[model samples]
Target: MKWPWTLQPFIFYPQGGGQNGDQGWLRAGAEEWTVTGTRLDKASGVVWHAVAGELPPVDTQLSGEVDAHSRLRQMARHTGEHLLAQAFARINPAFEVAAVGMRGPDCTLDLRGSPSEADAQVAEALLREVMVAGPLTLETQLVPHTELGRYPLRRATPLTGDVQLVIFRDTAGELFDVSACAGTHLPLGNLAAPVTVLGLEHIRAGLTRVTFRAGPEAAEYLGEVYRSARALAQGFNTGVAELPERVEALRSERDRLAAEQSRLRAALAAALVTAAPVEAYGPVQLRVLSLPDAGLLPAALSEVPAGEVRAAVAGERCSVGSGVPELDAGALLRAALTVSGGKGGGRAELAQGQTQQPEQFLAEVRRAVAEKASWSYVCHSRR
Candidate 1:
């Protein structure tokens, strides 16, 4: 259920404008409610809180707490994104910030103008230079909407009410960037170092999306990569730089072993055909076999004796065929499949199908065969 903000100063920012809503606990003396989610109403500019347990009475003096760790991490990454955007614009005058996202540990930027890998590397290098170059100063100002044109704004202002402008300035008071935003951020964008461009992916017609990480998350990511590289080098008894050749060799060896295993499986299936017992069923010689691979049926049947009737069940798949042209093996297969909830069709001498239950397939085949044998006996007695 939703709790309206009219009764209290629910100053907690609701999830909107690319920032996630705050999550924490709201306490009133001895009772506390866990706030799991929060949302904002665009039409009414109202904030709503989604909480667990019964909310305290209206107008109850509740103490609210926000998860500062999560908030600060997101704030730091957002500031780093602003720095990256500013650097890109300085390097390429035509660069435009199309869309940006910095939530949790994910930081992504999409640009209408395509940026090559080299261009991204250069932008990253420029960001690193400023990272070491003293912390930047930030100032916020509130001014009338008509006076927004006096500064070099990133984009035109859409809101006419008192707008908040966040300005990043170097130590010398020169402006790094002037953009209108309302999210919490660090005083210096460079404080969220060392920001790096992960990679670039071509989204569509001239648009490229760049993924990046900043602050502690970036350090953790690079540490994981280095640890994995060291582990691989130790496992292969080679240096990290020679890992590519060793990995390719291992892949080649794996493929060769897989091929060898397949050849052995096929040979084993064919051998089973020769080992099956020959049984008499009225005028026909029959050999029923169960195997693991249904695809091996054709190869196994190639070794069957002439004039022998065959039925093979492998897992949930089964097939039947006869060397004797007079015997309608296809009919027998269909009759068996019916009992097993399966489907099959072929010439009167051969048929194939799959069964719903592999364990019941053999029993169904035996019943169909016994019924056919009984009918044969009745027809011969009438003759």
Candidate 2:
């Protein structure tokens, strides 16, 4: 069910103006209705207020009020749009207002042309000039389309009947910008406070969108930027300008420490090669050593004499090398535990690969030694 209530002396600005509707409360003595939004019908010239809860008595004297803070921000943005359009033209005389919108605290204007960085800066400078200028008074009134030719209109309007012409005039009544518009604006329909040109983005072919913030929104954005910069500078013990240099220095120091730590770890792990348990089989000494560093495995095998062989392991990685000319430690290691999706490859005397079972790899090394020595392998099982 919808109740179309007629409000008198309405403070709510209906949703148009390239911005959202005003939100607030409609009161009837003790009972209150929350106005969540307002919608205006351009065709019927009727305004609807979307509210929560049941409707109040008809013909009941009710009061309405808008969210004052939000209303001010939106008014400032609407005012900023006219200034931006004129500023954009100052940079490129041929530019046209392809689209414009005011959402919350942000305002955007899309022009139908490419705008370079320098062009944006020049426009932004002009935009700020109007934003910071002395109190602006908008001399606007309704005028027929036929009389548009008398003034220096900013753009042509398609409206056939009476059009609302926003006149930029001086105290002496000299004209400046004259454009037809229907959106809500400041009393003077100009920036109430300074504005910030957030940035410009090339959306696509020949369309450049300029985003900006005005009044309280602009001041808040600048405040947040300064606060963040100060926090970063304080944390790094440097000025904002030197922040990049300080960060680079810290990164270099971290890399140097990591490299030094790796060298020390590899040196300490080399001791594991000599610590491995050895099995003597006539002429060959078979050593099995498992360490945490794979790079140190090659150095460990070098510790073995000319007639010895070593199988060094680090995590899932394995390395086998033999000083003996006849034994292929590479083939022997792969054959020991070729189970469970494991694979290996190397020269006849050395091989390095992954193994699921380290103990199985060691067993194969021992078997190769026993077979070479022609010794019968015996399994001792406890009964």
Candidate 3:
């Protein structure tokens, strides 16, 4: 239900300008309603409180309480966003805010220009410096729309009538920022919680989105990151500081071992190919080899004798190679696997696939070879 109580003395902050609405409870006599969210009717200039429960009688006196802790965090994030935007602006004027969202777990701001890594670093550093410099005061003032030119705003506003200016200044009364906004804000001192940049990504053409967290949320995010890094480092038997080096070393060692294994497989394949018996069938020579290592299949197939069709099987995988231009290795293998109900394909010179029944696949290949070579002559020899 909508509750139009904006005119009365109210503590709830209506949702506007990228800030979340206040949530709490409203009570009158023995009845109470949970204020889920508050929203402003921008077109009508009316604030509405969305409630969950029975609606109270018109003009019934009611008391409301805002969730102070949640409000405080929200204020911190809002002010932090202002500080971050200012820092980025200081780096480059083109880094103007195109859009913003702060109602979710993490706050985000879309910038008009793409910021480099160095720009982001400098912006973060500047933000940190301003944050820890000293206690800064955040104040608001209602100014006529005509007088808005007196303040230098980071972004332009389309608001008419009275504009609420959220201003921040240092302890020495030096102005830091002034913008037209109705969102809640906190003094820089009260918002001394850590701020962290989560990441930056290109959301669209000529626009970059920056995701970040502030206050207790940022502290929690940092804590989780540390815990995950520590766990990974412990697995590698090293400290967090040495984790990256340890991972790189392991990758290098893996590559070295892989190269040595490939060399050994190639040598063994050459020996196997040298001893393999060739069967003669009419005008064609055929060779079938069953290898223990699938890694050796490619090397073994590469050693095929001229004018011979070779098929090698390792585990479930099989490879076929042909040196004769008249015979199509891929076509033969495709027919054989088709008969055995397996799946594979390749070019005329080479083909590869897998089958559950290796013996059946080999038998099909042998039958196909016999048909192609005819029954003119048959013999076996190794040379």
Off by over 4 Å in 2: 1-3, 8-10, 131-133, 170-176, 188-191, 241-383
**TM-score for each candidate, following the candidate numbering:** 0.64, 0.62, 0.76
Question: lDDT for every model?
Answer: 0.77, 0.74, 0.83
In candidate 2, what are the lDDT values of residues 157-264, reduced to their tens digit?
Answer: 788788898766533455646778876667763454566788888888889898888777888888998889889999988898888888899899999998987677
Candidate 3 residue spans exceeding 4 A from truth: 1-10, 29-32, 46-62, 189-192, 234-238, 261-338, 342-383
TM-score for candidate 2, please give it.
0.62
Best candidate, TM-score: 3
Alpha carbon lDDT of residue 205, candidate 1? 82
lDDT of 1 by residue, 240-267 (tens): 8888999999999999998987788778
Best-first order by TM-score: 3, 1, 2
Candidate ranking under lDDT, highest first, comes to 3, 1, 2
Q: lDDT score of model 1?
A: 0.77
> RMSD of each candidate?
6.6, 10.0, 5.1
* Ten contiguous residues minimizing lDDT sum, candidate 1: 1-10
lDDT of 2: 0.74
